[model samples]
Target: MKARSKSKSKSSILFILCVIAIFSLAFTGFKGFKIAGWEIKSIGEAITKGLDLQGGVSVLMEIQEDDVPSDVRQRTKQLLELRVNKIGVSETVVTEEGEKRIRVDIPGAYNSSEIVDGLSKTGNLEFKDSEGNIVLTGKDVKEATAVLDSTSSPVVSLELNEEGQTKFAEATANNIGKTISISMDDEVVSQPVVQNAITDGKAVINGMSSMEEATKLSGIISSGALPVTVKAVSVKNVGAQLGAEALPNAVKAGVIGISLVFIFMILYYRLPGLFASIALTLYITLVLIVFVEMKAALTLPGIAAFLLTIGMAVDANVLIFERIREELSIGIPIKSAIKKGFENAMSSIVDSNSTTFIAALILYFMGSGAVKGFAVTLMIGIILSLFTALIVTKILINLAVDMGLLKSLGQFRVKRGAENA
Candidate 1:
């Protein structure tokens, strides 16, 4: 009996520590406490905002058909989308406007001219030696990555294909100690001196100011080339004034709705409801963390999806609590009742959440813009809700019971009587 008591005491301490850790992580994400002298942004600030929330540049381009096939136009559009996404722009929209025109919408971009210049360029990478002789092209490149050099300076490392290996080896051998100019769209992006003949197809371009510049160059080089040239026929600047006005109202509604949910859970299920509320708080924090980590863009529809998942999170707790009540009404012991409750609730919870996840997956693949954002956020929220409801809530309730804080079925609003037995 003494050993059992000691074990229970240890379990109680462990439970308390887990709760504290959860709260600390949640608080850090929500309030963003600083360490040392560096400032960390809160989860809200870390998440990328959509075009509707933050204004950016939109451009419509006409694909010039100088003997270019229709398939080339489509390929060009796809390549442009890849390039834009590579630049770290979240929730950017690239859609075919017509048979020959493509539309590009980039969020969080303030400079229209800079974006236009980047998007309009063909991004064809080439290496030229002195006397203006072309040594290698992007097609000969196998891969490109940004890395830190020996001095901790940013540089782009390149891997060339078989043909490129031969050509580069010959070029470097013939032009040792000479400068080779690397050009993108016929403009010199980098010039590096050839130290030796590179026979292994591996090379590095140094002298980048920052990692950002090196990464940009690497991404452009790795994205391949557009099959056809695109000319920007129209450019428009989108303003975020309307979205800014709507943000406060959206936040107010969300807060009010979630407050009502908390109150309902606490009042309806009593003890179990309180535990569920805490788990739901953790759920919200986890979802936001996922959004930030994924670099997902949050739009108006995405916010709606997040709110809807809160209700689903509560629903999961309600199901489990109802099962526990049923078991208690049958005069089962509290510990056995909790175990049976989760066991009975598992099938229903899995079925519902699985179906919802499937729907979200389909929407994500087929939808565009705001609809895609909504689907992505909904899927993430649903997964996190399941984790908190099924795992976190059960752990907390069991810990409370094991600690002797909850001993009677009466605490869960179930009376133990002869009739129940």
Candidate 2:
């Protein structure tokens, strides 16, 4: 009797702890707080909005192939993405359009002309001496970053590879007082006189008016040269007003859909359904927390994917509940039926969720823009749904049985003809 009493005590404590954790996550997700000088953002602030939901510039560029191979065009597109990202633009979309076209969408950017100019260049960085003798090129550069000089002025730091280091050292040693002009796309961006030979593979270019200019220059140099040229053929601007209009309706539909699911589950399955509903609520909260933490961009399709997974979450619970009911009708006790139901339903749940997860994984890798966002959210929701259904629901059901809230098989509403003898 004492051992049984102790076991129940432990179970009760675990049940309380689980409730506390769920509530804590919900509070943080809905209403963020600050602690120890660190601020945690609410889910609304944490999730990044995409171009369709926020105002941005979209440009369609046609590659000037000029006998360039298809592989080089693909590589140029990738490099362009890197340059865009390096400029501190988050949630930017760079994707291929057709065989020779590329599309770029930068959200929350007001100056489309500046962005277009920045992206149009081939970004071929070159260092030449006073007499116009080439010394080092972007291919020899290992990395570049923007930093402050000793006098607090903004400057760009360059780190070179072995070959660049050798060539640069020789150039600086030969031209101690002469200016080495650093140019991008045949335009001189910076011209600095070498005070001494730099043998450590590191150098700094100082002429930037501000940190922003230095950052842009560093980003361009780091992005490397494009394999082929591209010219903007079309440019479109998406307004934030459209996104603002669509957001509320999408959220309303999601809420109404989820509420309906909750009502259906409760009316049909009674006690088990109520437990499933609670677990599902926890699952949604956890999924949002994950999205915020991952800094994932939420698009319109992502919201749809989230709602779809909510239905799938309840489906798993229904399968387990029906299995439990079947076991109860066959003369099994409530506790044994609950355990057996989960054990028997595990395989089916795993098979279904795994296949869905694989599909989402494929889409994420192969798709771009909105499709990738949908795949990301779907993958997250599926994983969290499985967790809540298998782990959280099981724990809650066991706790209810242990607390004597669930006693007889009749509580599960077993059919008259199938009742245990």
Candidate 3:
């Protein structure tokens, strides 16, 4: 028994030390390691921040009429979001603010006026015949790009899908020797005369005076149109100062809260508490790694969800630890008690976490903007917490028992008088 215990102790210690070292390096980063696909940095630096944290432009747009339908409002918000994304920004928030107003928040944006002007346009790209008949719409265009024509003039190029190709061919064939006007929002931007059939599924708008105009027009064309005309009511630039101050304060609070939990667990559960703390650390490290890999934006609400997950992780540990103590009080062997404790607690852990997971899914699908951000982080946390509590904590505890580190009942927070049955 002594020889077996010694061997188990060596192996368990080696495994535990390996886990600690690897996670520590991942959390803080190492000189040679580049797991985050770039320069090695702390976990905090790897995550992308939202507009509230990084600062950018915020625009509020209101529809011209008072009684806009809900579907129109949603479509407008979605189109604005697409336009923002087309300009190369990520994690932009576009949501309906009221019955007639929509709000847009673009992170890392510097040109407020440019964004507001570009995003508020009623895209409505239309191809019209010489007789003013509609030939094609923006929906039929597959791609749009800005390029210089052979004459050294900037123009917007359009690649038509099968449907657009057919319609455009018919329109050009019929309008030969006549001008077909290309218009956006009822304003004609190009009126090129048709010289040939031009049935190759491609067309060009050549009225742009500069490359910038061509690019902007192409981007707007690529990102579809809004159903209704909206006007920007407010546009402002936000600074990073608010998030800079709040981030540190939030981190400090999380540290204090986790530290208190650590102290309480160590005092109440003795040996088991120390193992739980280590598992908790691993849980946090894994969560951060996942966020980095996903390139997820970390907002203030996301940070709050992260902290809440720590408590949920610790709660699972508390449940399993209590179960083990109960089994120990009945004079069960340490290894058997650990096994039974995990088995008994599995159902409850799955039930609770699964319910919360469902709720998070609902919030993710039905919610918008900041609410979606909160739901995403909460879902991630619950998953990682479940993994640490059920798998990592169990392995650590079984290792301790195998290494004879739990020979005394007091190690499990049970009374010493509970005689071995």
Worst 10 residues of 2 by lDDT: 412-421
TM-score-based ranking, best first? Answer: 2, 3, 1
Worst 10 residues of 3 by lDDT: 26-35
Cα error, candidate 1, residue 113 (Å): 7.6
Please give each candidate's TM-score. Answer: 0.68, 0.76, 0.74
List lDDT for all candidates, in order.
Answer: 0.83, 0.85, 0.83
TM-score of 2: 0.76
Inter-residue clash pairs, candidate 2: none
For model 1, the superposed segments whose C-alpha errors exceed 4 Å read: 58-103, 109-225, 229-237, 416-421
Per-residue lDDT value at 345 in model 2 = 92
Q: Output candidate 2 Cα RMSD.
A: 4.8
Model 1, residue 271: what's the lDDT?
75
**Cα lDDT tens digits for candidate 2, 247-326:** 78887898899999999998888887888888988999998888877867777899999998998898899889999988
Indicate the residue-level lDDT of 418 in model 3.
52
Clashes of each: 0, 0, 0
Candidate with best lDDT: 2
Instruction: Pull out the clashing pairs in model 1.
Output: none
